[model samples]
Target: MDIKGTGAIVTGGASGLGGATAALLAGRGAKVTIFDLNADLGNQLAKEIGGHFIKLDVTDADAVEAALQEAEGLHGKARILVNCAGIGPPAKVIGRDGKATPLADFTKVIAINLIGSFNVLSKFAARIHDAGTIGGEEGGVIINTASVAAYDGQIGQAAYAASKGGIVGMTLPIARELARYGIRVATIAPGLFLTPLLMSLPQEAQDSLGRQAPFPSRLGRPEEFARMVAAIIDNPMLNGETIRLDGAIRLAPK
Candidate 1:
């Protein structure tokens, strides 16, 4: 879909993949509204991009609903939604101490990553379900963020992988169900990237991770991920699929 003048919402848009996406969308002339917990960064980026920002927790249904309403008030009903609000704190099912990991750790990951994405998309879909098509095109597009770990999870990533796997699992069925509403759903499973979490590590550690990607031999750029998002939005046939944005990297079992 042509992004020009269309309304778009990007969750977790303060930094990292979602941040790049919000900038790209706004640069393409889309009226962007960013939903994130980082108010300072979110507000700064929104102002820089000529967009809007709302402090939101994607897992909260009521807050999400209110944020969506506020965003629509600022920029018309959003026609594009990119779900990038997620977390990936690795933890072993069985820790070094030998006791089982706390169940809350697992549930928290699922709640923020899997259930959170679903909450935003479902609500976005409902809002646009009956809306008029944009420029005679489909109703809207939803691009979700997944991870390669969903497929090849290493040790200490059970909760994180499960959450992303759930996202990958639901893509097709949700796409099929939303088809009648002229909405498309797809997920992108990214490999190692230079996100804030990764950047916090030592430079040498970051370089080691970058070398893991076979071809590129470097970490994936946030803007590159943003570009893939744009490509998916531009193409109508790309639905109900999970595209791996990892540069041919099959993660090792660390």
Candidate 2:
């Protein structure tokens, strides 16, 4: 759909990939609302982009519902929803101490990464499904963030992988279900992007990770991911598929 003048909601838009997306969408003339936990960053970005910012946990159903309503009150019904609220703390099933990992750790990742995404998308879709068509054919588009780890999970990535795997697993089915409403659903499985988490590491470490990708031979940039989001929104035929923005890299098991 044409992004101009449309209302768009992006979860985890305080920083990193979501931040770039919120900025890009706003630049494209969409009235954007950033949903994230970091009030400082979210508010700053929102002001910079001339958008709105709502601070809340993505897993909180009531908060999410309320945030959606507030966004609607500000920008009308959102026609674009991007699920970028997720975490990827690495942990093994069995630790070096020869003890099983805490189950809570695993569940926490699933809660925020998998279930959290579902929460936002479902509410966003409900708000827009009955809305009038955009570009004469589509009501809205939902883009979710997955990771290459879902497919090439390394050691100590069990929780992260499982959470992202759930996202990839759900994309097509949700797309099919939302299709009747003219809402398109898709996922992006990014390989190794230079997000805040990775940027905290030393430059050498970041460079090492960058080399993991073959062609570009460097870490993926957040704006590149944002551009992919724009491409998906621009193309009506692209739906229900998970695009790997990995630069042809199949991650090593590590």
Candidate 3:
């Protein structure tokens, strides 16, 4: 899965993990297309990195199809697909007020995080499959983003955890199925990272969260995650698995 001189598609490529990945691949000579809901950031990043940007909403099937068509038109059919389009608004199943959370909250999380990833991955893979084998040995690779919370969610994270859990649960099965097509599938379960969402917290709060990690206690760098993505793309044997990109941190119950 050499990235140089190939086509790659990264969902949610406007910011955070996906943005880092897009930059990494583009830097390595891949023709990257960013599929993101934020046209402003996506367009800015595209120009900055010399990649293309397509406004996309991963949860919409028709929009996904159309966006991929446009992306492939610009970059050719993508041999790399990274699913990083997700949302995590945490809520407790039972609040301290004694009322259970609204069912809509759970559904929204599932829709955007779980089903959204699948929607983009499946559509992108299908498009690339139709285009045929890419470089030499492999047709394509798919890297999905999960979270540490999938395994050890804290309080007020039932919806978020369940959504991520579905991603972890499906990685191996999807990999097995896609193996025949010379396509590899893997997921990354990141620990506490200083993504924009977390960085918005107070400085002390951020430090406190970082200190929770067992050793070398600090938030993860986006470049670090990008490098792991490159490693997975480079190694054909690293399929059907989810790699945890976190520090040695198991979250508390909270």
Candidate 4:
């Protein structure tokens, strides 16, 4: 999709991958609305990019609907929706501590990583459906974020892996269903990116992880992921698939 003048909404747009995507889209002339719980950063980004910011909790259906309405008021209906809001709190199903991972912790990951994505995507799509087509197309496009862990989760990532796995599994069917409406769905399964979470590790540990990459032998940049997102949006044929942005590396068992 040509981003110029198009309305785009990015969840988790305050930081990390979502923030990069939002900035890139804005730079490409898209009218952007950042939907995130981080009011401070979201508001700052909105100001920086001349876009709107809506404090949103993706898991709350009613709040999401309201936020979408607010965004529409600012920049029509969204033609691009990006789901980048997720959490990865690692925990073994049965830890060495001899205690099972708490159900609430596991559930929290599912709620934010899986259900939250669905919540925002569904509400945004519904709103787009009501608004009809854009750019001579039937509707809009949605890009969801997954992780390599979904396919090769290490020992301490059971809940995180399952949640991301669900996202990867649903991409194709969701795209197929939305295709008739010209609404495409695609997913990005990123490997060790140099985001705040990963960068916080000690330099040696980060270097160790980077060395695991097969060729480039380094961590990914958020901009690289944003570039891929732009490609997916521009190439109409790319749909219903999860593309790995990893640098030719399958993770090791932890």
Candidate 1: worst-modelled 10 consecutive residues by lDDT: 130-139
lDDT of 3 by residue, 159-186 (tens): 8999999999999998998888889999
Tens digits of per-residue lDDT, candidate 1, 212-235, equal 998899999999999999999999
Superposition error at 219 for model 2 (Å): 0.5
List the global CA lDDT of all models.
Answer: 0.95, 0.95, 0.90, 0.91
Candidate 3 clashing pairs, residues 3+ apart or interchain: none
Query: Candidate 2 lDDT, tens digit per residue, 1-254?
Result: 99999999999999999999999999999999999999999999999999999998999999999999999999999999999999888888898899999999999999999999999999989888888797689999999999998899999899899899999999999999999999999999998998999999999999999997888999999999999999999999999999999999898878
The segments of candidate 1 whose C-alpha lies over 4 angstroms from its true place after superposition are none
Answer with 2 or 3, whichever has the higher TM-score.
2
Off by over 4 Å in 2: none
Q: Least accurate stretch of 10 residues (summed lDDT) in model 3?
A: 128-137
Superposed by TM-score, candidate 1 places the C-alpha of residue 75 at a distance from the truth, in angstroms, of: 0.9
lDDT of 2: 0.95
What TM-score goes with each of the models? 0.99, 0.98, 0.97, 0.97
